[model samples]
Target: MSDLRRRALAGGKTVSRKARSKPESGLSSGNHTPNGSPGNSRAGSRANSRPGSRYASEDEYASESENDDIMTISTNSVSGEDDPGNTWAERLQDRVAELQDRKRSSVQGREATLGAYNHLLKHHFAQRQLDKSVAELMPILLRGIRNGSSDEERLRTLQAFTLTVLTCSPETIFEQALPILKAACQDADAENVKVEAIYALCIAVSYGGGSSTAAEETLDFFLEIIESDGQSVGAPDSGAVVTAALQAWAFVASHMEDLTVQSEAAIEAFIEQLDSSDPDVQTSAGVNIALLFEAAREYEEETGESFDMQYNQHRIMTRMAEIVRDSSKSVSKKGRRHLRSNFSSIVTSLERGKGPGYSTAGRAGPNPHTGGPRTDEQGEFREFGYRERIRIYNQFLLINTWSLHSRAELLKTLLGGGFGIHYLENPIVKDILGSADVEYIPNAKSRK
Candidate 1:
């Protein structure tokens, strides 16, 4: 064994005379203390000079020592020393510039350099380690999506960019990420790339300011994707694509006022997806439809004009009923609740009196009693049909009449007079009267 190894193994004890005689060896240079410090040389020499130190009994040393002499060398070795003053940022910038220069030289080099850039992007995103320089790198990352040699590289870069954007400050992502997503959405070769880009775009929209613009652009791009020849073989099965589009629609539906300015074709494309085989797509489509209805309803209430429902109310009601009666326990439970909760509005609209032959015009034919002229005696009696009176009574029963005394009185008058509840022995009326403890006479004269 070499002198240094031998002395290091000696557990800080005095060096033997035989070891000291080997001055030419690296360990005898006086700078070879086990702790790697030259200051410990005198301590080692004095211990060695003692009479029995060199030949000390192993048990004596063991009994005196509290610990084994284990050298603690740092694992981090500095090789071919570089300037310590250079910051990590400077080094990274130099490395990035060098790779860019190499990429400018040859196509093969460019591909290799791009691969490294993508790898760094993924690492930074996964590590969530963003710095000021990363903002500068954002354009470079965007360029990779545009110039990537393979679809896989583009997809990976796009995904990394999206996560980075989502994790980044809103202002930074808005400024750096939105344009790349928009460009990627337009490129036909970058189908998978579109998925992440759209997601990032949706995130950008959620950040406010140019959000509506981003939403419009994203919607247009998605409509193009769904209507593209590539999507003709089968519907767009891309979940990311569907989710992004749906989220954007929800954002726009809630925020944007100029729906007419949005492309009609986009709305139609979404409507078409309502029939998609994919349940997620169908659910999103259904939500969008509901949002549209809510928006329309608000518009009508604000302006007092009808907005086209654009869907068959009867068909929807029938489907809801089927869902309510579905054999699947889960379906029946949820569906029945939804139906019972929503059916009154639908039934009221359908039961609202219309012109003669109105209901029959579009279907099997109008109900004989729906719009027919009243008999002279019936008109004199001021009576309503059994179904019509029951519907009105149900409507009144659901109102919060207890808190609104005037509303309660108005309801009582309407039910007793116009609805002819004064003469009817209706179970609904009986329940309402029993709950309120108010006597209702079917034939009672109006008091007011």
Candidate 2:
């Protein structure tokens, strides 16, 4: 392992611009209970505790425990001078150029390069900045990923590339970044790099505004990885790579309007995945099952036709219930708890004939202004369909569809502390979340 990554995983200090703070990542599942939102109760407490629960990537440092440490860089690190008036674009251009000129052969120089990139990621970049700097950033980022002196540098560069695709004009960097990401996904020597590469590719396809055909093709690639049990990527069936592939597949699939054509075989695959011993792999597979059911429900409603999933619904729920109540000695307390909470929500969604978050206690229905699932005699709870809510600034962006929810979850994990800033300033982010139901709170404190 690279020295930097080894330090990070061992909970030692590594180059980070600021001491990481636990931002109130509004990514918490908002299932409403009788008392209040699910965040207040034990069953739903996991949502508040780990904001980046679904991310299998190495960048999820913020979700680590309080004891985990990172070395901080002072303001002068970027350029020996303090220039408060410089925009992010100017600073980024200067830093990227500095990194390019630095010798990777020198240990100090390489660490400095990683710190510079980390500092950029800590702050939000406005659309103006991204537009001005993306052209200059892409080639350097590509080189850092493919030929950095260490794995840590490559991983950080890949993360930066991900944020770029999410916030910048896709046309500017998509073509350049996609090919490199594809090659990285198949890299046999670096499993962490390959897992991260798979996720980065999914983000590129999702927000790139590519055609539906492109999205399907990318999803097919991920499915092959899962079906092959990571043999496609040279990893084991229960490895993190397969878990990442499963999540990535669901993240992309959530965006499609109708997945009926692929539902039966895809669902069967998911069911088989549930038998895997890895808790992460099991949870990911379970969520995909719920996602498929959610998609099937919507399709049937829209087309006024029967969307037969061809699987036994009762049998699936029984398996999900077993995981919820599981008390096996093999699984740790934390793992059991996570499994219970997630599957409990899934079970509720299935029983209620709603989507993933519906079964949780404290959720309100989709924002009333944005039309949602049909309202009926069951009151607002019944109206609570599948969607996730993101609390950013004073606005609540309600991602009222499973597809948008999947995209939002992944973006939240990638952006971390910068998510609210990007949502407020980046037009590309605005476009991806454009259809979300918006709720404005008059005087709420910002939750970035």
Which segments of candidate 1 are over 4 A away from where they belong?
Answer: 1-131, 169-183, 186-191, 205-214, 227-244, 257-267, 300-309, 312-314, 317-448
Find the number of clashing residue pairs for candidate 2.
8
Write one digit per residue (lDDT tens) for candidate 1, span 39-97. Answer: 11111101111011110011011111111011101101111123334322232233245
Model 2 lDDT tens row, 214-325: 7788888888888888887677553678778877888879778778766777888888888777777777787788888888888778888988989878899998877656
> In model 2, where do residues sit more than 4 Å from their true spots?
1-90, 100-111, 172-176, 359-389, 446-448
RMSD of each: 30.3, 12.2
Which ten residues in a row are the worst by lDDT in model 1?
A: 47-56
